[model samples]
Target: MGYLKNIAIAVLALSLFTFVVLFGQLPALRKTPLGTLQRALCLHLPNGLRSVDSRVTGGNITSKSRRLGQYLFYEQNPVVLILFLFLLTGSAALFLWNALHRLPMSLIVPLPIVLIPPYWFTYLCATDTDHYITPANHQDRLRDYPYDHVLFRPGAICKTCNLVKPARSKHCSLCGHCVAKCDHHCPWVNNCLGRGNYSFFLALLLTLGVLQLYGAYLSYWILKPYLVTDATRSLPWREYLPELGDAMVEAVNMGGLSIAGVGLLAASTAALPLGLFAYHCYLIWAGMTTNETQKWADWRDDIADGGVFKTSREALLSHSRPRSPEGANGAASTGLAVHLGVTEEEPQVRWPISSAQVIVRTNDGRPPRGQETLWTQIWSLSDVDNLYDLGGWDNLMEVLNGR
Candidate 1:
């Protein structure tokens, strides 16, 4: 029982740590206590360890570990995807093998329904390559989303891919290509969850949560005979708590490792996927990707420091620059130019909603030199426009259509 308690506590601690690691850097939580903890863990702790390692081992340990970390994270590998499948399938098999016979027909009938989608969706997410932006499809990908002139703007090219970065698209070093409508490269799927497979990723998260919850319910059902007692309710208020604890331990002991241990893990770690799904829902609602959220957070920080400036495209154009031919010059060449440091070829996207406002972040916390009259310091994000957000409903519909 003590060992079971220890396992539960360990599982819970791991789940919480995973939650903080995954969510702490998000724009919505980057300023919160969770963010502080994440900085301490991911940033401060690594730096401190490097310092110690430098002193003790002449940086050899740090070099080796850094290489390993880089390979694990930066290289395109199936390690995480394999590990995820192993854990998921192993746990489901353990739970069902032990708890299936004892459960009622109602529970037994729903097991396959609950369990199958994660595997199906995970395969879709993992094996999907259609989202990977290639030279062949690069031209078409450019028309995917209009530049917001904030997080993403015209004329930015991915040096690695040697191609113009489409709006809302990003080059993934691990994936070895630019991904269309890039959200983030998810290691769990060994793929970039973007235009083609992002919807599948969403379904995987939802179904994974349902599977874990169902497994947890089955565990509870199997142990119900032992957990239930007249004494649990009959006992006095103060005594009832301890009695409930004893009953839980007894139930766990009765179920043993296959049922109890797997169930504990399922219940404890269920929040990771479910919580991630909720966050993605928010992202869709706001019409931003995981990549865009971080970009927005950086913009938010710059705005806070008064380094960000805003102006209309018309105003910038009127103040300066002559237009070149549409094909030879980029989209911004007509609206902005060399003065703004963006003169590369941009996609001639036929977007429904065009953004007039252009934003820039200055290192000096002032407007560009000599263009002071045209620029205005933007103090709030509300003053800016998000071109992708056609309200939440439309955004959701676009996501549902796998756009």
Candidate 2:
């Protein structure tokens, strides 16, 4: 039943993909006003079908052109296409075979398959905001009917969400909740990186960016027009315009130019991922996340007090703060509170920082000028009669105790 369910889901996914790609979105490429006239005069072929002349709807040359192009390409391109299909099908089969045979599915297989597809599509169909394009003009209403007044702002943050929000907060529509310092929910990671997993998420994105750029380089070269005849190349854009008129000619020319321009456009698009990767790297070195970066930019003056490091140290120590609140022993809360917060932000001490720095700040701030005895502080802090001091690492226990 499990195997059957997987097969059913896979088939449904593939069928839906085919329907959407073949008949839904891609076919509209041929119905453009420019494409319509091109097909009328049989000037160029539509993308999927091959010939524009043959598929003419109104007994026009456009139909004939589409048909002719489709036929010519189909017959000639069969060998190349069949080889691609065979490889793709074979790979799928091999994957299924391993799965069915109870082979130890390594983490490697699903990682790339899951991560790359969404990322590739994200890059491929990216719009101005590095988000997926809304099909048709679905979101055009938001743009066309601009709200200039104060009432326009959709303040989605509720009271509960407001208090929990630290800095760089955003509401995830899919998750239907406000996340603290949210970056993006990544399916490949299989974990929503709010505050806990953010650093690792940044690292993953950096690694993916490198992998994708390398792949795009290889795919770009392979798609370069190697077998094009000069007849195809020599036909100037101007010459085609005279025969097909401005619109049809432009369509025909674009159809051809698109074949060549893909690599150049891809190279240009490469800059986005590269630039993002570099920006994040800079943030990591500066001990910041996307959230922190935004906050730093928004309130640069607040950092003047040198509170950032102090606050980070406080948050780091918050977890292990001594909880002996006026016990029977009444030991003068000899426990020193590390004032890590530099600025006035209340929860700034709860923010994330490196573990090493956390320990250092909690143990001793600016180790005493000469008597820099780390063990002295450790022994003092760990020396409660009823308490167990599981603090030292390995044989360092004797060394710390002796101090």
The candidate that achieves the highest lDDT relative to the unseen native structure: 1
Which 10-residue window in model 1 sums to the lowest lDDT?
324-333
* Per-model root-mean-square deviation over C-alphas: 4.0, 23.6
What is the Cα-based lDDT of residue 178 in candidate 2? 51
Cα deviation in Å at residue 72, candidate 2? 42
Off by over 4 Å in 2: 1-158, 162-176, 184-193, 196-216, 219-259, 302-403
lDDT of each: 0.82, 0.35
Please provide, for model 2 over 91-178, each residue's C-alpha lDDT reduced to its tens digit, 9 standing for 90 to 100.
Answer: 3344334332432345335436543553443332221121211233223322321111111112223453342222334555444445
Predicted candidate 1 versus true structure: per-residue lDDT over 66-156, tens digit per residue: 8987877788898888989999988888877877788878879987898889999999999989998889998888887777778786677
Q: Count the backbone clashes (under 3 Å) in each candidate.
A: 1, 31
